[model samples]
Target: MRYIFFFFFVLLTLSGCNKHEEPSSNLIVSSFKLPPKNESAASSDAKDEMAAPASPEIPQKIIKEASLRFETDNLEDTFNRIQSAVTLNKATIQNDSEGKDYNNIYRNLTIRVPSQNFDAFINAISKGVSYFERKDISSQNVTEQYIDLTSRLNTKRKLEERYLQILQKATKISEILEIEKQISTIREEIEAKQGQLKYLESRVSESTVTIEFYKTIAQKEGVKTSYGSKIWAAIQSGFYSLSEFLISIISVWPFIIVFCIFAYFIRKRFKRKKK
Candidate 1:
């Protein structure tokens, strides 16, 4: 009975110890012990409003520009459409030539076409030719170029405006001269860029097409000759030869006469000395 009472007393002591050592279930535990909210509701609302969706950023004015080189075998057809292409593309023929050898006559032409219709224009041009001698199609993505031009132009324009304003406010002639000089230089640069843009626009507007063709040698139809006609031609040629000979002799008659007179005098002097 004493052993059972001691066992019960030991169990009660363990239970009381466990109750004292137990962790509080209501106590909050977290890895990140963050600070309490100090920001006002309006401030939090403003932050929420400022946050934006993860939308892909769009580029401004995506410019399309390119250049190409193409060669064709059917030069005739190529030439025919070449003018039209130039007009359509606002371009010009850079080079064109046609020549003949003993056997053949070949034609060569270099043309520039527009960039907007570069591919479509090339397709149209290819259809006109028999076959391509060589098709060298290339593309230079000039989005960067256009963007660069725009930036440069904008900056230069602002500079130009500033210069104009300075010109208006100038007090001294020297200052005016210096400003004018600077303005001139800026204008020259602007003109150069404008020219470049025009050229690029023209290139993009038109495609360059180089055309070459060789004419095939054809057989002679027939050989016809008459004996009477040949004789007549010979007679005419002989008469012309005789007239030329007579004219040549007559031309030098004065010199010939002088030589003969000198010769006669020398002979007479020799004969007199011998006598």
Candidate 2:
């Protein structure tokens, strides 16, 4: 009876101790205490501010491009002038080509310049040019596109950080793999957005200009075709016609011979009748 009573008392004491101590789940909950009403309201405001980020000031981004085609009497002089302008504007010549067409000897240049000096370079090139066969200037605004890419990139970076944090806390290999996959996807998106942003920046920073100038062939040689050329062409045409006639005659030589023999017999018959 004494042993049973001691066992019952020990069991009761253990149960009381368990009731006094906090459970694992409640201990976790108690670690983070609720703030007062005023503090809570301030925290909520802070969260609202964080959730809605302020819009960044976006300077206007413009891509400028121009193309000009004209006629120049002296190619060397005009090219020298353009080179001077290019030097003054700190421009780079991407491509320089000279070719002769049917009626003109032309030179084409592709130039890249700083966007800030685009106008100055254009004006410098236009100083001595009296006429242009074609002149085109275009401007494109990419501010919105740039801002969008930047925002998306930032968001992806934040998402990747969150994924990394989750990966650290993960215990199972499957969970880790899944989190890593998500991180990889987010990283790819971030890289792509960064690339787009870089492209936009490059375009905005640099401008492209294409210039084509040509000297007309008529200035050097007034006549397109001389009388001798016309005579030669006519002779060539006559020779070609003669060649075609010979080909036609040879194409049906047997039929031609047959017709000739029949005509000869008929003529002889007529002559005999006449006699």
Candidate 3:
């Protein structure tokens, strides 16, 4: 009976161990069955995000301008020299004007040159200049404005694209018309922005230099007149006045002839009455 009981206890112990071992084995199998696809997908997404390119840096934009006034000894010579300097610096003359006052000769020039050569061109023209009456240099930073325009243009284009897509999918006439109207408005805005951007780019790429140069005449150096020359001039002036008076009389010849005829008729009538 004791041996039987001991054997029975040993069998119970073995059954308990089997029960515990079975579940652990099943747990191991279940753990292996969990899918690795989720982890792989997450890793792939991370790689894609990391591999994406970043936005490019924006270039700097600046507009430059200058104004200068100079006094020159010789107007024509200085103008020619300025022209030569412009040609050497690959600049363009946008406007040019020359005039003479009572005692001074002056020239105004508006020149445009590449921004990169702005300083050099200015220096080149300043070489022979002894003094400047006025000098002004200005710079405007347009990078922020440029970037803002670019971003707005991009946004407008995207909005236009979205409108087009909506138009394609629209079934009602009202919806289609509304989409078209929105697209038109967006397109107009885009064009205006584009034009503004182009203008800004042009200003940034080229620098403006306005120049006003003049030469003065000395009063003491004026031509001196002799007495004989003055007398001759007076005689010429009197003769010119007499000629002008004669011309005025000739211009009224028809009226003068009519008046003479009326006077003769009156005198004839008076003689008839006396007879």
- The numbered model that scores best in TM-score is 3
How far off is residue 181 in model 1, in Å? Answer: 2.6
lDDT of 1 by residue, 24-91 (tens): 43243534566425324433443444344454532433233333334444556656776676677676
For all predicted structures, in order, the TM-scores are: 0.46, 0.64, 0.67
In candidate 2, what residue range of length 10 has the lowest lDDT sum?
A: 36-45
Q: Tens digits of per-residue lDDT for model 2 on 1-275?
A: 99999999999999998887768668889899764365346445444544597766778999999999999999999999999999999999999999999888999999999999999999999998998889999999988888767666665666577678879999999999988987888788788888888988998999999999999887435454666788899999999999999999999999999999999999999999999
Candidate 2: where is the Cα deviation over 4 Å? 1-61, 75-80, 87-90, 95-108, 133-148, 216-226, 243-258
What is candidate 3's lDDT per residue for 1-275, written digit by digit as tens? Answer: 99999999999999999999999988888886542365345344444543475768888898999999999998888988999989988999999998989989899999999999999989988998998889899999999999888867766676677568879999999988887987898899999999999999999999999999998987755555456678899999999999999999999999999999999999999999999
Query: What is the TM-score of candidate 3?
Result: 0.67
Provide the lDDT at 199 for model 3. Answer: 98
**lDDT: worst 10-residue window of model 1:** 60-69
Separately for all candidates shown, the number of backbone clashes (residues 3 or more apart, or on different chains) is 9, 0, 0
